[model samples]
Target chain A: MSLTHREFWMMVHLGLGVMFLHTFFEGILWLHTGERLRRLRIGTGVMALVAWLTVVSGTWLVYPWYRAKPPAGADLADYPRAYLLANPSISQWHIFGMEWKEHVGWLSPILATAVAWTVLRYGGQLARDRRLRQVLLVLFVAAFTTAGIAGALGAFINKVAPNTFLDG
Target chain B: MAHIEIDPVTPSIIEEINSLTSSSDRPALPNGQAGAAILSAGIGSALLGFFVVLAEASTTAKQLMTLDAGVGPLSGKTTFAVAGWLIAWAVLHSRWRKQTIDFARITMIALILLGLGLLGTFPPFYMLFAQH
Candidate 1:
């Protein structure tokens, strides 16, 4: 069965959350391990790569679905209208559905690739090196925490916001 | 016959040296590495806090502007609060600073609490209590 927009978004959230949670655990494990920095680097590197993929895929999955629906009734029409009024260019682009692609689609893959590369190339050493590991651990914790918060907010919105035609 | 028994001076010299080296003169606790670790953790926690704020703001903005981006501001606030606390605690523990055994035990308990807090944001509980 085809998934509803809400289901799709929830799935995307779940995917991204799992990816982030995986990365968090990997960082913690790296910190705990007494092994060489190289080992930790590889471990974290692999986890980052997987997480990036998840994020990219989730982004792709969510955008078309998000754009297909109109804003929920609770969403202030003034915001989008004001944004359009302020940036005619955005309004023009939105006419053809190009705006969504321009704003979110174009950047998703590039960001995912960049994150993946950073983690793979420099992250291993960071994971193994004590000082670096500390930094990465902090970052991991921060990213994971932020994502979790964002997901909760999204869920709340889904629950409370009136599903206008845009929500379809 | 003029060879007098010369007592060795080595023992006396050693005793003199030992006497000069007092225990109080020894260096204090090794705080250098521990201090560095704490500093690192502090910086990390701060960065995490900043990111959490950024993420929450972005979500709020998106929800406000984007059509059908239904996430509410309250959930954003709640999620950030919970996540921020956990992240702060994690950074503090990771700093590996000197703490009493009781504090260490409490930190473990705090970690569990953090996990539960995060979990509580999920379905069922969130839907049950959070619904207006």
Candidate 2:
């Protein structure tokens, strides 16, 4: 299968996303178990960085291509947004799925950064502060949920209208 | 990452740790730092949702928010939200840095804001405000 630049970055974004989620889950487990505090701090920091990169790249690089306007009277095949919208049967993918994915997906990085900061600030000490740990856990889970929603919708949209360049 | 071995904390261990915390060279820092970050995150997320709804509802707003032609209004929405979050965090941190803040209340408020942000960004919910 020929892979375009857009497709390549999309895959990188996906891989990083999966990696972030895994790291995020491990953080939750560490907090839940109340062990490995230092590890959680460092892991969370890296995860937060990955989360930020994913969101920024998704928004700046991938999204622009996905939403690129096709020239007048041109085939919409290269324009994922236009392609999705050109047909009523699948327009919902862009309006509903893409809309939600683009906006809500942003929450993950913001919240993850907060979580990372908290962990780094109060590493092993979190084990003593149940309330702090609980609060972080809740926010952490919320971040995960947002990323999961965005990722799922992104996968569906990509399946229906894969965002890729015509030339490999 | 280098591993720093820590004994697994049980309930009894937590109590013991708490007791030793003050005597130890490093005392537990104020919860204010965490609170500021958490609360500001909520603020950012909620504002982002609000921006989504606003941009959808108003053409002028959409145009104003379209910081980059390539990325559309999204660039503005995220930029504004992130700026707001950082500002809020800085302000909150300065005030609460030295003192212990009420985390329970902060958490509740943050959660509510987060929920609003989530609801606001939901396609169905925000689309209701769409002009076209």
Candidate 3:
């Protein structure tokens, strides 16, 4: 069966989330002594590839979503847009959260690339050095946290938007 | 000589790796610090771009051509942000290549600078002050 747009997008999003979780797990495993650094490096490299793919797919997902509008002349019916205009404080907070999610989401590729590159270049040192391991741990946590926050914001947008893939 | 032979398959390879890890003469690696800063720079610049675009969306939206295709200032702003981040990363990477400075410390410094750069782009700070 041919995949619908919603199905395709859903699959992509699921892939993104899974890749992100995979990175998180690999990062945790990197901190352990039992696993060889070489294996973890390869794992992170795969995560980076998946992450960049996710970034591209997410962009495809976002563009149409951002461009969406209500049926012509449906002013106040736009829900959050119209409601948000009347309430500046709530609007600001909502906008801030939305923007934060979008912006941070863009860093997935960068974060994943960094993790992969660092491991590739310094895996030996990182495996041996406590201090370096700590830094890597922090970077991993930050990347995971950003993905989580961005995903939360996307869920919020789906709930508030005029139409969502779930509606059909 | 006593005929003593060791299997060179698993144990020898593992022992070699162990010996390498124990060696103290290894070159200084980035330890994930510079890479982290570069990654964070992407986040910071994207955030800065988002706020900057939002601050100017009212005016910029007018000049931006909205097509049947979703071409808008938001996409432009994102592109601009990502470009800026790539440039910043390039510069940092160059310095990282040349310098012998403590990798983690320098990365922290870079992160702080990028964070400050982000704060500078806030609407209340740059936009408001400029308009006045």
The model with the greatest lDDT is 2
- Put the candidates in DockQ order, highest first: 2, 3, 1
TM-score of the B chain in each candidate versus the native B chain:
0.30, 0.80, 0.46
- lDDT for position A6 in model 1: 56
Model 3 clashing residue pairs (backbone): none
Q: Native-contact fraction for each model?
A: 0.00, 0.68, 0.10
Per-residue alpha-carbon lDDT of candidate 1 for residues A60-111, written as tens digits (9 for 90 to 100): 4543443432345644432332333345555543332322222222122222
Candidate 2, DockQ score (0 to 1): 0.44
lDDT of 1 by residue, B1-108 (tens): 698775797666555345334322553222323233323333333332333334334655435433323322322332344354446545654554344234334334
What TM-score would you give candidate 3 relative to the actual structure?
0.68
**How far out, in Å, is residue A166 in model 2?**
5.9
Backbone clash pairs for candidate 1 read A37-A128, A41-A124, A69-A166, A70-A166, A71-B67, A71-B68, A157-B70, A157-B71, A157-B72
TM-score of chain B for predicted candidate 2 = 0.80
List interface RMSDs for the candidates, in order: 16.2, 3.6, 4.7
Better of 2 and 3 by TM-score: 2
Report, to 2 decimal places, the DockQ of model 1: 0.02
Q: Give the per-residue Cα lDDT of candidate 1 at B72.
A: 26
Clashes in each model (backbone N, CA, C under 3 Å)? Answer: 9, 0, 0
